[model samples]
Target: MSDMPPKLAEIVDEFASAPREVVLEMLLEFSDEMPVLPAELRGHEGMEQVPECQTQFFLRAEVQTDQTVTTWFDCPPEAPTTRAFAGILAEGLAGATASEILAVPDDLYNRMGLATAISPLRLRGGTAILGRLKRQVQEQTGTPT
Candidate 1:
């Protein structure tokens, strides 16, 4: 059975606050047809590869939000479903160290911070601001050396 476009539109109306243009545009524009490949008479093949195709709408909406948009755009593929993100300003300056966090380029720092906020269930959450201390510790250093 196929889902009509209007039915999908109804779903979007339900979640009025979400970026509807991005998600709906992606779903409606998706094409289910696959390119036909000739039968191969060779040794056993374990699996057929699925095509990797995603619309630019999601990326465009995210990029357009710009430097002022201090939010994470993507969701983690794995579970522990929900996320909690707070503004960088909201995090407060208490345990933050200037030397480690400030040294990284502004863009990388932003990305790390976003990733951390979006996946607080992961150990790497808001701590992304602490660049060096977050790394895996080595046997010799007992720190992320």
Candidate 2:
């Protein structure tokens, strides 16, 4: 419901020294251990990693219901689309896909003046993946979602 994309951008800016792929990998690893959705619903896992510091993020949402969401994380992009950890969990929000992640222009990195070492994971929830996870729970459970 909020502007989560910009927040994620802030995170990308903060950890400008860690490899964006590494940051994204760590995020997915954590997300899987603690699925953004109900643990009983579905499970999250890392599928693949692409060049340009982009990682493939896959979500098996509604596993019990046969629903799934998969997307990509591009460290740098020409247009720089934004996606917060929270916004990703929003019911209807389709997070980045593998192809989209790979589609990022090679110039994105230089354009953003970001180093390949940028961590991509922000310490604060500026992108707020955790906050988004909590909100997602509330929405799905109807208790806080």
Candidate-wise lDDT, in order: 0.24, 0.32
Counted clashes in each candidate structure:
0, 14
Residue 12 lDDT (model 2): 35
Q: How close is candidate 1 to the true structure, as a TM-score?
A: 0.17
Model 2: CA > 4 A from native? 1-4, 17-37, 43-57, 60-115, 118-145
Model 2, 50-100: lDDT tens digits are 222233333322211222223222222221222333232331224522222
Candidate 1 lDDT over 58-119, as tens digits, reads 00011112211111212122221111111221122113232222332323323323332233
**Deviation in angstroms for 34 in model 2?**
5.6
Largest TM-score belongs to which candidate?
2
Best by lDDT: 2
